[model samples]
Target: MLILFGWRTTIEQLRMLSLVCGHCHNQAAHHLFRRRTKPTIFFIPLFTISSRYGLQCTFCGVSYDISKADALQLGAHV
Candidate 1:
Protein backbone atom coordinates (compact mmCIF):
# COMPACT_ATOMS: atom_id res chain seq x y z
CA MET A 1 0.00 0.00 0.00
CA LEU A 2 1.13 3.55 -0.72
CA ILE A 3 -0.03 6.84 0.69
CA LEU A 4 0.56 10.11 -1.05
CA PHE A 5 -0.08 13.59 0.19
CA GLY A 6 1.08 16.99 -0.91
CA TRP A 7 0.30 20.67 -1.01
CA ARG A 8 -1.06 22.81 -3.77
CA THR A 9 -0.96 26.50 -4.44
CA THR A 10 -3.21 28.38 -6.79
CA ILE A 11 -3.22 32.00 -7.86
CA GLU A 12 -6.32 33.48 -9.36
CA GLN A 13 -7.46 36.94 -10.28
CA LEU A 14 -10.63 37.42 -8.33
CA ARG A 15 -11.66 40.60 -10.06
CA MET A 16 -10.74 44.09 -11.11
CA LEU A 17 -12.50 46.77 -9.19
CA SER A 18 -12.44 50.51 -9.17
CA LEU A 19 -10.29 51.63 -6.28
CA VAL A 20 -7.96 54.41 -5.32
CA CYS A 21 -4.35 53.68 -5.96
CA GLY A 22 -2.07 54.79 -3.16
CA HIS A 23 0.87 55.34 -5.42
CA CYS A 24 -1.23 56.96 -8.11
CA HIS A 25 -3.10 58.84 -5.42
CA ASN A 26 -6.27 58.76 -7.48
CA GLN A 27 -9.25 56.65 -8.31
CA ALA A 28 -8.34 53.98 -10.81
CA ALA A 29 -9.01 50.42 -11.75
CA HIS A 30 -7.14 47.97 -9.62
CA HIS A 31 -6.84 44.21 -9.69
CA LEU A 32 -7.69 41.90 -6.82
CA PHE A 33 -6.11 38.50 -6.41
CA ARG A 34 -6.56 35.53 -4.14
CA ARG A 35 -3.66 33.19 -3.51
CA ARG A 36 -4.83 29.98 -2.00
CA THR A 37 -2.80 27.14 -0.56
CA LYS A 38 -4.22 23.84 0.54
CA PRO A 39 -3.28 20.35 1.49
CA THR A 40 -3.97 17.82 -1.23
CA ILE A 41 -4.68 14.16 -0.85
CA PHE A 42 -4.57 12.25 -4.12
CA PHE A 43 -4.72 15.55 -6.01
CA ILE A 44 -7.83 16.56 -4.19
CA PRO A 45 -7.88 19.51 -1.85
CA LEU A 46 -8.27 18.18 1.65
CA PHE A 47 -8.31 21.48 3.49
CA THR A 48 -7.21 25.02 3.20
CA ILE A 49 -3.76 25.62 4.58
CA SER A 50 -3.62 29.33 3.99
CA SER A 51 -5.08 32.15 1.97
CA ARG A 52 -3.81 35.56 0.98
CA TYR A 53 -5.19 38.66 -0.66
CA GLY A 54 -3.42 41.10 -2.91
CA LEU A 55 -4.05 44.50 -4.41
CA GLN A 56 -2.44 45.43 -7.68
CA CYS A 57 -1.93 48.97 -8.83
CA THR A 58 -2.36 48.92 -12.57
CA PHE A 59 -1.08 52.43 -13.05
CA CYS A 60 2.07 51.88 -11.06
CA GLY A 61 2.41 48.18 -11.69
CA VAL A 62 2.83 47.36 -8.04
CA SER A 63 1.16 44.71 -5.97
CA TYR A 64 1.13 44.00 -2.25
CA ASP A 65 -0.53 41.75 0.23
CA ILE A 66 -3.47 43.09 2.18
CA SER A 67 -6.15 41.92 4.56
CA LYS A 68 -9.21 40.28 3.05
CA ALA A 69 -11.62 42.72 4.67
CA ASP A 70 -9.56 45.72 3.78
CA ALA A 71 -9.13 44.54 0.24
CA LEU A 72 -12.83 43.96 -0.15
CA GLN A 73 -13.66 47.38 1.23
CA LEU A 74 -11.21 49.07 -1.08
CA GLY A 75 -12.29 46.97 -4.00
CA ALA A 76 -15.88 48.00 -3.73
CA HIS A 77 -17.09 49.86 -6.80
CA VAL A 78 -18.31 53.35 -6.03
Candidate 2:
Protein backbone atom coordinates (compact mmCIF):
# COMPACT_ATOMS: atom_id res chain seq x y z
CA MET A 1 0.00 0.00 0.00
CA LEU A 2 1.10 3.56 -0.62
CA ILE A 3 0.38 6.53 1.54
CA LEU A 4 0.27 10.09 0.23
CA PHE A 5 0.50 13.21 2.36
CA GLY A 6 0.72 16.99 2.01
CA TRP A 7 -1.71 17.09 -0.90
CA ARG A 8 -4.71 18.65 0.78
CA THR A 9 -4.37 21.89 -1.16
CA THR A 10 -4.05 20.02 -4.42
CA ILE A 11 -7.20 18.02 -3.76
CA GLU A 12 -9.09 21.22 -2.95
CA GLN A 13 -7.97 22.83 -6.18
CA LEU A 14 -9.26 19.91 -8.19
CA ARG A 15 -12.57 19.88 -6.37
CA MET A 16 -13.13 23.56 -7.16
CA LEU A 17 -13.39 22.72 -10.84
CA SER A 18 -16.68 20.88 -10.36
CA LEU A 19 -18.46 24.09 -9.44
CA VAL A 20 -18.11 25.32 -12.98
CA CYS A 21 -21.39 25.54 -14.84
CA GLY A 22 -21.18 24.06 -18.31
CA HIS A 23 -24.07 26.17 -19.63
CA CYS A 24 -22.67 29.56 -18.69
CA HIS A 25 -19.04 28.86 -19.53
CA ASN A 26 -18.08 31.55 -17.01
CA GLN A 27 -16.07 31.34 -13.86
CA ALA A 28 -18.08 31.68 -10.70
CA ALA A 29 -16.80 33.88 -7.90
CA HIS A 30 -16.77 33.13 -4.21
CA HIS A 31 -19.63 35.12 -2.92
CA LEU A 32 -19.77 34.61 0.84
CA PHE A 33 -19.78 32.05 3.63
CA ARG A 34 -22.98 30.69 4.99
CA ARG A 35 -23.50 28.85 8.24
CA ARG A 36 -25.00 25.39 7.91
CA THR A 37 -26.57 23.32 10.61
CA LYS A 38 -25.27 19.83 10.83
CA PRO A 39 -27.65 16.97 11.24
CA THR A 40 -25.54 15.32 13.90
CA ILE A 41 -24.12 18.47 15.43
CA PHE A 42 -25.75 21.68 16.54
CA PHE A 43 -23.60 24.03 14.49
CA ILE A 44 -21.09 23.63 11.72
CA PRO A 45 -18.97 25.99 9.67
CA LEU A 46 -19.47 25.92 5.90
CA PHE A 47 -18.18 28.08 3.11
CA THR A 48 -19.42 28.94 -0.37
CA ILE A 49 -16.53 29.04 -2.81
CA SER A 50 -16.94 30.81 -6.16
CA SER A 51 -14.79 32.11 -8.97
CA ARG A 52 -13.65 35.68 -9.41
CA TYR A 53 -12.79 35.40 -13.09
CA GLY A 54 -14.66 35.24 -16.42
CA LEU A 55 -18.12 36.51 -17.21
CA GLN A 56 -21.13 35.35 -15.17
CA CYS A 57 -24.21 34.86 -17.31
CA THR A 58 -27.75 33.62 -16.73
CA PHE A 59 -27.12 30.33 -18.52
CA CYS A 60 -25.35 28.92 -15.48
CA GLY A 61 -22.56 29.44 -12.99
CA VAL A 62 -19.05 28.49 -14.03
CA SER A 63 -16.03 27.95 -11.80
CA TYR A 64 -12.55 27.09 -12.93
CA ASP A 65 -10.00 25.00 -11.10
CA ILE A 66 -7.28 27.16 -9.54
CA SER A 67 -4.40 24.76 -9.63
CA LYS A 68 -0.80 25.72 -8.97
CA ALA A 69 -0.25 25.88 -12.69
CA ASP A 70 -3.10 28.31 -13.09
CA ALA A 71 -1.69 30.55 -10.38
CA LEU A 72 1.67 30.63 -12.03
CA GLN A 73 0.13 31.46 -15.38
CA LEU A 74 -1.86 34.29 -13.82
CA GLY A 75 1.24 35.68 -12.12
CA ALA A 76 3.12 35.67 -15.39
CA HIS A 77 0.20 37.35 -17.15
CA VAL A 78 0.17 40.11 -14.57
Candidate 3:
Protein backbone atom coordinates (compact mmCIF):
# COMPACT_ATOMS: atom_id res chain seq x y z
CA MET A 1 0.00 0.00 0.00
CA LEU A 2 1.20 3.46 -0.82
CA ILE A 3 0.83 5.81 2.10
CA LEU A 4 1.49 9.48 1.87
CA PHE A 5 1.46 11.69 4.94
CA GLY A 6 2.71 15.11 5.83
CA TRP A 7 2.09 18.10 8.03
CA ARG A 8 0.67 21.35 6.79
CA THR A 9 0.55 24.78 8.39
CA THR A 10 -2.36 27.09 7.81
CA ILE A 11 -2.28 30.75 8.71
CA GLU A 12 -5.58 32.60 8.96
CA GLN A 13 -5.87 36.33 9.30
CA LEU A 14 -8.10 37.14 12.25
CA ARG A 15 -8.28 40.89 12.48
CA MET A 16 -6.57 44.18 11.85
CA LEU A 17 -5.87 46.74 14.54
CA SER A 18 -4.15 50.07 14.84
CA LEU A 19 -1.54 49.96 17.54
CA VAL A 20 1.99 50.94 18.42
CA CYS A 21 4.55 48.29 17.68
CA GLY A 22 6.81 47.31 20.59
CA HIS A 23 9.73 46.61 18.31
CA CYS A 24 9.54 49.61 15.99
CA HIS A 25 7.58 51.91 18.32
CA ASN A 26 5.55 53.10 15.38
CA GLN A 27 1.82 53.58 15.24
CA ALA A 28 0.65 51.29 12.46
CA ALA A 29 -1.82 48.68 11.47
CA HIS A 30 -1.28 45.24 12.86
CA HIS A 31 -2.65 41.93 11.65
CA LEU A 32 -3.67 39.13 13.97
CA PHE A 33 -3.35 35.58 12.71
CA ARG A 34 -4.11 32.06 13.83
CA ARG A 35 -1.64 29.43 12.75
CA ARG A 36 -2.52 25.78 12.86
CA THR A 37 -0.46 22.80 11.85
CA LYS A 38 -2.26 19.63 10.90
CA PRO A 39 -1.25 16.18 9.90
CA THR A 40 -2.45 15.02 6.51
CA ILE A 41 -2.81 11.63 4.96
CA PHE A 42 -3.09 11.34 1.22
CA PHE A 43 -3.55 15.08 1.02
CA ILE A 44 -6.42 15.00 3.48
CA PRO A 45 -6.13 16.69 6.83
CA LEU A 46 -6.50 14.31 9.71
CA PHE A 47 -5.95 16.27 12.91
CA THR A 48 -4.23 19.28 14.29
CA ILE A 49 -0.62 18.85 15.38
CA SER A 50 -0.09 22.29 16.85
CA SER A 51 -1.56 25.74 16.97
CA ARG A 52 -0.25 29.26 17.49
CA TYR A 53 -1.38 32.86 17.47
CA GLY A 54 0.53 35.80 16.15
CA LEU A 55 0.31 39.55 15.98
CA GLN A 56 2.29 41.16 13.19
CA CYS A 57 3.07 44.79 12.48
CA THR A 58 2.50 45.89 8.90
CA PHE A 59 5.20 48.52 8.76
CA CYS A 60 7.89 46.80 10.74
CA GLY A 61 6.94 43.23 9.79
CA VAL A 62 7.55 42.11 13.33
CA SER A 63 5.62 39.11 14.62
CA TYR A 64 4.79 38.35 18.27
CA ASP A 65 3.20 35.32 19.83
CA ILE A 66 -0.04 35.74 21.73
CA SER A 67 -2.34 33.64 23.87
CA LYS A 68 -5.13 31.56 22.39
CA ALA A 69 -7.78 33.40 24.41
CA ASP A 70 -6.65 36.71 22.97
CA ALA A 71 -6.65 35.26 19.47
CA LEU A 72 -10.21 34.01 19.89
CA GLN A 73 -11.33 37.42 21.11
CA LEU A 74 -9.69 39.17 18.21
CA GLY A 75 -11.09 36.66 15.74
CA ALA A 76 -14.69 37.29 16.74
CA HIS A 77 -15.39 38.25 13.17
CA VAL A 78 -16.05 34.59 12.55
Top-TM-score candidate index: 3
Model 1 misplaced stretches (Cα beyond 4 Å): 18-28, 76-78
Candidate 2: 10-residue stretch with minimal lDDT:
7-16
For each candidate, the alpha-carbon lDDT, in order, equals 0.81, 0.31, 0.88
lDDT of 2 by residue, 1-78 (tens): 653322111112211222344565455543211122222222332333332222222335433433445444434231
TM-score of 3: 0.87
Worst 10 contiguous positions by lDDT, candidate 3: 69-78
Quote each prediction's TM-score.
Answer: 0.68, 0.21, 0.87
For each candidate in turn, give its C-alpha RMSD to the true structure in angstroms: 3.5, 12.5, 1.7
Q: What is the lDDT of residue 49 in candidate 3?
A: 78
Per residue, candidate 3 scores C-alpha lDDT tens digits across 1-78 of 999989989998888988899999999999998889999999999888788888999999999999888877775343
Error of 2 at 6 (Å): 18
Which candidate number has the best lDDT?
3
Provide the lDDT at 16 for model 3. Answer: 91
Alpha carbon lDDT at 44, candidate 1: 89
- Residue-level lDDT tens digits of model 1 in 1-78: 777889999988888887788887878778888888999878888877798988898888878898888867765322
Model 3: residue 28 alpha-carbon error in angstroms: 0.5
